[model samples]
Target: MLAHNQDSLKRTPLYSLHVSLGGKMVPFAGYDMPVQYPAGVLKEHLHARAAAGLFDVSHMGQIALRPKSGKLADAARALERLVPQDIVAIAEGRQRYAQFTNADGGILDDLMVANFGDHLFLVVNAACKDADEAHLRANLSGECIIEQLADRALIALQGPKAEAVLGKLCAEAPAMKFMDAGPHEIAGIKCFVSRSGYTGEDGFEISVPAGDAERLARMLLDNPDVLPIGLGARDSLRLEAGLCLYGHDIDTATTPVEAALEWSVQKSRRSGGARAGGFPGAETILAHFDGGASRRRVGLRAEGRAPVREGALLFADSAGGEPIGKVTSGGFGPSLSAPVAMGYVPTNLSALGTKLFAEVRGQRLAVQVAAMPFVKNTYKR
Candidate 1:
């Protein structure tokens, strides 16, 4: 469990190392975080696309759970009562992205569940860890164990050349495939390393003991291809990848069906099936499958150089008449070299190439519903 004392935010294992590298510190999720460095957001985004960048994500929470009596399969099944994924079929050392939902089918939080040896290792967002932990503890069966890895530090190395840069630190790095996870020693420090990341690129997430985090971070940064990245670039990179940001793109107000994340819900969870609808809000979510969602999330491309920020109003046409929806997340994409955004629109208006307009200040900018991820993903197979 994380220490709730005020001093917990004072420093991370890489605190001094981040300062040494010119990391601009800011408060985020109850910890001192780096927003960016002297290289700026654009440069960092490009660098991660071509090379590798080290991100200090130690603030994320890592927790482990195991069946108190029987095998892990039963515990995983219990978890399926909250999420829609078929966790019983999840193999060992592999992670599956899933979300927690409320009774109304709204998302509580999205997290990664890795089935380790006889246990489930969960990596959840720091901002929601307290609530998530309470939810899990109250929902899970009594015949299970929960252990929090708050003392561990997490780091991500992502990009096209990530493997090459990580290989210098661990010889076994080259053998890891996409979504595969295993333990490896980096310069004598052991870490739970996974070949996955938020950026739509080849990468690995290294989880190490809090004490050795700084040493390993320095070693990775020492590589010519690796630079320190922060939360600002992280958000833009994920947005450009067409990935959802929990609070902005999704929430307890948005169901998985409307969020275009039906892929996370398995076939067995369908309406009236054998394993049908065991989770909270299952009735509402399963109904969305047979019929359809009221509003659907889609990509938006704005005309001209002006970037549309969240809360911007969307109009039907260039005339700036009726308001259809609002911008959820919008910014200038460093990779696409253009302004990109995501928001919900009427199901009929969600089609690609549909014409609409985003009102920027007094100007009604010409906008269109477009295919997402403006940039193609390079995730390794």
Candidate 2:
């Protein structure tokens, strides 16, 4: 990490391309990037669901882990000590979403791990990249070689037509199912393509050399179904899909079980398995799974037009009874045509159909605990 002038934010390789495409620039994660294009956030979001949208995500960190023993299982075993998930089970050319947790079971950062044929590839959050690299080095360097892929750029192509659009460029892209990653050549440039994205739609996340990012982006944008999207739409899309936005829905204060993410923890890592309870904070996280967490993360549906926002207080009654919980990620869902949010509330009040009220701007707004994904996920199987 290096000191930087607040006014002089960093820019990605696609800065000039975004500017040329009428992008609205803003500061995000220490980078001056596009928040939206001329078509606006709402349209950008809908376009991704209807057709296809290309997004610049080069701000995220990409790292490679190579095992000195030449055993891929060694790399996976090394990561299990820091996170709760079963990384060793991820087959070749597939991806697994996981988090780096601290000793207290609090998530340090959420990341995506891909098992390429010979080594493991990781894509960590942009803001936590430095710290994540440090943590990996301090804990697993003796078992595996860690290399940061800083010269690469990441872009996501999402929507119903994403497969058709990318398939036209690389014949092998559409062959990949959800969470699959494979190497391919697009526009005569080599890249690693993954059939996954933050958006809940079927899509591909392409990682290419930073020097060739703009060219590849331009080629994809030339398609009739493809349009450039920005961060504003990216947020709304992920929210409607009920995906957590790191620092918001999850943080150092939250654990996998409390966040309703036990599904990500492999069965082998839980109690009763032969190799269970070896990861950090195993006692705290495992206990919650058996005894139930005191508080749970849940999805809320706003009863009115007002969008419930993060930090809003939750009450069990409209009369503003004692606060029960608080909103973590709240926003208007473009696809749902209603406000959707996720929050933390007492376990007894987390079941679907429970009535609740969110305090917005001093006014209590009625809400209901609802099933997540405010919209359905359209990922390619």
Candidate 3:
């Protein structure tokens, strides 16, 4: 996360509420965000997995794309020009994950694209929001209306009990399947809700007017099954879920294929498909789809209790030879009660059960390549 001076840091709508709840504030993405609460990161992580965790993600960017030609397909097609995803195929009231790619096949930023009938809604990383808006305006202003929803506050209600807690306020919560997104009324507040979140649990992300954010958050916290979560636990949860953090797990230098995100690129955007090779870096990215990338992102399991953090160099063996790869994200997974991490390694060494060594504190710690999502996902399909 990007850090800025405390004086220049922005505050989310829930800042006061977080302070009232005794949250430990820290600079994140140029905003003063809570890193943890009184209950601490460990408890918060486990609570979310067992119950529900409400997260203040107002820092994320929300944008709306309306077609000038009065057709949603026009907007989708225009978006397809920038991202490799099949936006045109996204059904109404459904959303899909996508990435903005550079001409050299590097990812500019990752985002969510939701089809809302006449328009498309996008949620992008907070640190990349400004640049992402500029990118859209530069490439899609003519074919679509690019409006940033700066007045909205995004709240994520994640975990297994998310539905039970949110259903008390919105009846439609029970009917919404994973990735289903649309407008809904919660506690008499008009909001846009999506059954998706960073955690590998069934949940909902609600976008509400900034003014009513505190009230909505307070109401959600009123439920016994829900607890307020902060950024610390959020990171560990996503890491355990095998999800990528924008700058750490992915960035401008990482291609989707190299990051093991080829699944986000739909078949329509692949070679010989209907809309193939129109996006930026289509040649390079698509080539990787056919020939494969030199390295692939894979999960890593440390043999001991010590966590191998980001930037830790990976070696082929404990004896110390040439560095084979590097750890990108790592921490103690609360769900697993052990250290889990994700890193990039040569395809030959990325297979499950492949043994590797990570240099931590000048000591070569044994690590094994493992399958991702160390914790099983409980999405309600």
Q: How does each model score on lDDT?
A: 0.86, 0.92, 0.95
Q: Which residue runs does candidate 3 get wrong by more than 4 Å? A: 1-4
Q: After superposition, how far is residue 124 of candidate 3 from its true place, in Å?
A: 0.3
Q: What TM-score would each prediction reach against the true structure? A: 0.95, 0.97, 0.98
On a 0 to 1 TM-score scale, where does candidate 3 land against the true structure? 0.98
lDDT score, candidate 1, position 326: 84
Deviation from truth (RMSD, Å), model 3: 1.7
For residues 1-381, write the lDDT of model 3, one tens digit per residue.
333367789999999999999999998998999999999999999999999999999999999999999999999999999999999999999999999999999999999999989899999999999999999999999999999999999999999899989999999999999999999999999999999999898899999999999999999999989899999999999999999999988988889999999888888899989889899998999999999999999999999999999999999977848999999999999999999999999999988999999999999999999998999999988
For model 3, name the residue pairs that clash. Answer: none
For candidate 1, write residues 160-256 as lDDT tens digits: 9899988887999888888877678888898999999988889999999999998888888888999889888998888888899888999999999
Error of 3 at 11 (Å): 0.6
Better lDDT candidate (2, 3): 3
Per-residue lDDT of candidate 2, residues 1-381 (tens digit) = 234554579889999999999999988998989999999999999999999999999999999999989999999999888888888999999989898888788889999999997899999999999999999999999999999999999999999999999888898887889999877898679999999999899999999999999999999999989999999999999988889999999998899999999988888988886668778788888898889889999999998989999999999988946999999999999998889999999999999999999999988999999998888989889
How do these models rank on lDDT, best leading? 3, 2, 1
Best by lDDT: 3
Q: Which stretches of candidate 1 lie over 4 Å from their true place?
A: 1-10, 272-274
